[model samples]
Target: MHAWMSEASLDRADNRRKVPEWVSAQWRRPGARLLLVDSDGQVATDETGSGPAGVPTSGNYNAQLHTFLGLVDGIPWFTTEGPIIGPSASLRHLGAVTGGAALELTVGAVALTAWHRLEPHCSGCGARTRATAGGLTRRCPVCGRVQFPRTDPAVIVAVIDPDDRILLGRQSSWDPGRMSVLAGFVDAGESLEQAVHREVFEESGVRLREVRYFGSQPWPFPRSLMVGFVADSVSAELTIDRDEIEEAAWFTRADLAADLAEGRVIMPGKASIAHRLITAWQGRLLG
Candidate 1:
């Protein structure tokens, strides 16, 4: 699967959350659960470390910050910060381990919790805002301004040339031998396709055509929607930008296999869309 847990497993009752009484009813419902989000932006994990470890909604918690996540298999789920019961892990690690509704819940919990922590004050009035709408929005009491959660859009593309070789680059900050497809944030006043073309040229100096949407993933490290794509480059000539891309090169399937086998090239993990994009071009799984 391109996205392991990106299906509609949870019913996000947006309208229901707007009603205070309905939200309270859900909280009192039997089988209601609470997932703990830590200060480090990590979620509590089960003993196996592959699934979420939700408490029985039995302990003390800051109800104001308790965000209603929605229902998974007819069970209500909410997220709030409290004592982590067991081991905690980041979304990157959780993505690699879980699937289905659990993955969706964890993603939502992390994203909403992080947003709540970061956006406790109003951007417009510099006044403290309170969480409302089941933590979906924050309202400034003094300014009467409501703030919504923000998600930054980014484009990640797997670029292929006429020879069927894939273009991969290494960022200056990345570890040695680690490489992935070209990606960048969507600039203001730019379309997704335009961002794809601009990012490829700005980083690797390769103009692309046949740009196609591949898939998308919710990367909530600090809230971002990763839009994935595949494109064909006009030429394979390298004009690497040393500032963004430390090194870039075209790789045939054979070359990639050899490098990976020898531990000379470290591909992204199975959790990221970058891995899916590269493997799609490679015509098989890399790991």
Candidate 2:
């Protein structure tokens, strides 16, 4: 199941009940931990901090933290942490904590981490803004600009041919034998369909037509909205752009199934919308 769906179900269930007293009680518990973030884009952990008396130590400075709970896809989630200090000394020791997974550092995890640190100062007036409303937003006292999480909307399309083949691309940066759908961020002033057509043509040098929207997913790997689609290949020629993709090719349904079985070609991971789109398409064809 997708993380969003699981979280949504939890959220829907929470809505029917009263705000549990235990939820509030957890806030009062002393040992309940919070993930701390610093300005250098690092998370605070238990490995490096001064003791309460200012002695050299290894733990987070947990005072003055914020707290909030909300539903994403109806899941009950909470964030309780303090503002990030860019030059804080505590940030240097983050590697010693939790093996460098940012998600493990704090309650907000990876989804809420980047946005909170990205806009610490107001972009409009260049004045320092304060994290308010329990880390849900940043407010500029000087310019009164309220900032929230920014999610880049991107289109991921599976181009299909009249022969029932799907187009896939392999990027140089990916692990060995990994292939996935062509995807790109929706440029300013371009519609989703326009982006799908533009990116596919640009990367693969193949024109597309009859683009159809499949579905969408909220990819919170630092905030991205993935819009999935299926497009018809108008041309058969493969013109791969070496700069963007190492290889582009068409695969038949049988070939895809074999790849899945042998793990010869790694598809998109389960956390991503790309995986969902590709799996759904494969089911439609194989069924």
Top candidate by lDDT: 1
Model 1 RMSD vs true structure:
2.3
Q: Per-residue lDDT for 1-287 in model 1, tens only?
A: 32743558988888888887888778888899989999787899988788888877755434476898999988989999766867888888888878788888999999999898888999988999988778888989999999998999999999989888999999989999999999999999999999999999999999886899888998887889999988988999889999988999999999999999999999998778898888888884321
Question: In model 2, what is the error at residue 238, expressed in angstroms?
Answer: 1.4
Candidate 1 residue runs with Cα over 4 Å from true position: 1-7, 59-63, 284-287
- lDDT (Cα) of model 1: 0.87
Candidate 2 local Cα displacement, residue 109, angstroms: 3.9
In model 2, pairs of residues that clash are: 7-75, 8-73, 11-74, 35-106, 39-86, 49-58
